[model samples]
Target: MNREPKAKSQEPQTSGRSDTGRSERAKRAEGLPFASERLTFLEHLTVERGLSRHTVEAYGRDLEYFAEHCHERGLALPPQIDEDCVVAFGPYLASKRGLQPVSIARALAAARTFLKFLAGEGVLPADPSALVSRPKLWRRLPDVLSQEDAATLCEAPEAEAQAGGRLSWRDRAILELFYASGLRVSELCDLKLADLDFQMGIVRVTGKGSKTRVVPVGRDALETLRRYVALLRPKFAGPKDEDRLFLSRTGRPLDRIAVWALVKRHGRVAGIPGDYSPHTLRHSFATHLLEGGANLRAVQEMLGHANISTTELYTHVDAKRLLAVHAQFHPRG
Candidate 1:
């Protein structure tokens, strides 16, 4: 595996802070609940993934939120997470913090993705988020759901997982991975079997301009992917679909349009209001991470953006939430 290259300096300069001061902060971060892991995850994105500065900062905020949430609920480490913790966090974000459904969903998604990361890195025995479904947000609008409606949508996939069919398994795998890794429709359609690295829980993607990057796939998605590859893909595949990750009933590779249609179909079936496209999933993937405090550069890298400015477009999507924060905290407001 290719690792991040370290930089060499011609000259070294010392800051006013002493080594003891640096050690103290490191110790303090380690002592805090989930702080060390959070820092390591962010560093992985930075040094290992080559994510942009803005993306790293966003992830830092999201990790801090997770740490704070875990600290509040007395969840000191990954092992402490269970289905209840996952479920309860949603309500706490809603009722306690008065966050909108979109924000709440974003937070849960981030936590789910983060736990998957920990599990991949062997920090946890298994992915606790596997059984816990991601909270879905309405397209274009942050349409709020009744408590019951939210629960139903969340568990709908779990129910489907229990009553599995070849198509069901394949669809679930595709959808889970779409949100998990935030792949472009084209990138997703072009995926080959050889690209998946289950041990690392990542997929090597060739994005726009033929630039390739390896992105971490969340644990829950990886689980579904295993099932899809082992059982489902072979069922639908002909010689044409042999190497492709996704395929149609005719055993041909699926096109981008097919993926888009699948997302829309699933979104509607889940009772999610408004229309959805494959990019809708992509938008949600980036938006949720940012909303959860992912670094802007990390998101950009994951999305295979050539320029940081393109990724900044997602920040604009948070205008309302930004205004809400300003209203609550701004002295003049």
Candidate 2:
């Protein structure tokens, strides 16, 4: 795992950018440099854990960033990534890399996962990252469109269709389903035809970590999807592309970037202010449900969140709105 710590005089000075103006000191005396081990760990994540390509890539990027930081300090990745090094990594990402709290926390999470994997495989005596506590996140609430704005945005595609634009049914269904199901962009793009149960108004969605959940679809979304499949999907889907639920004009499954652009385009047309992505619809869906008195656990299950704490963040949003209303209408104020 890691080499024994040597005297400060014996440590070599390394040239690299560091968060602090002072040169970074190596936390550990010696350790194995990341090489084949990093690759094998990532491979295990993909093959054994069933993580999606996007998640695998994000983990790889975070690990690489950490590795570079270690190299600059004349240290190596775990078991060299000791408690002190792991502790400093959060601040380094913030001060040096200018990453926000959420991004820094995510990077640390990646490092922790990697260290745990190495420890599990007997590559290290113990997990160094385990001794490091996670950084506190700011918990910035997601931006949500108002109900009127959401409805207007969802209808933009159909309005275009009424003006004789092709692919309107597909776009409208995409918007409606996003609001109805709260599926992640990747999950929506990867949805297969068989994933939808229109008769039952439910869709089987595979979310982060490849966890699958069945979410109910509203009648509006299901009706739009039914029309799209019957009318537009067949026109776009080629012989080889019939399995996917959503297709491009070229018959390939719609990619995440396309969905992003479509959301932004329609948001502008509907005069919704500020940036909005597919996830905005998801935030709106969850917030509106909570505002309407839906149970917290129900929303968690619908969003396929692994932890209830993650879903609890929406409660904060409701609290903030209540404060605003109280301030505006209270007679004493």
Question: Which candidate number would show the highest TM-score if scored against the true structure?
Answer: 2
Candidate 1 residue-wise lDDT, 1-333, digit = tens: 221111012112222344566576556556668877887787877787776454565566555566666778888877897777777778777776788887677667777777888999999988887897677655444222333443333334554455432366777787778777888787898899899999989999987546799999988889989988987688777765478888766577776556666665556668877655666667777877888799999999999887998788888776766898899999986
Encode model 2's per-residue lDDT on 135-203: one tens digit a residue: 676789998888889899889987667756676788889999999888889999999999999788899
Clashing pairs in 2: 3-30
Give Cα distance to truth, residue 183, candidate 1, Å: 1.0
Candidate 2 matches the true fold with a TM-score of 0.85
**Residue runs of model 2 more than 4 Å from their true location after superposition:** 1-33, 76-79
Judged by lDDT against the true structure, how good is candidate 2? 0.82
User: Distance (Å) between predicted and true CA of 51, model 1?
Assistant: 23
Model 2 residue 132 CA deviation in Å: 2.4
lDDT of each: 0.71, 0.82
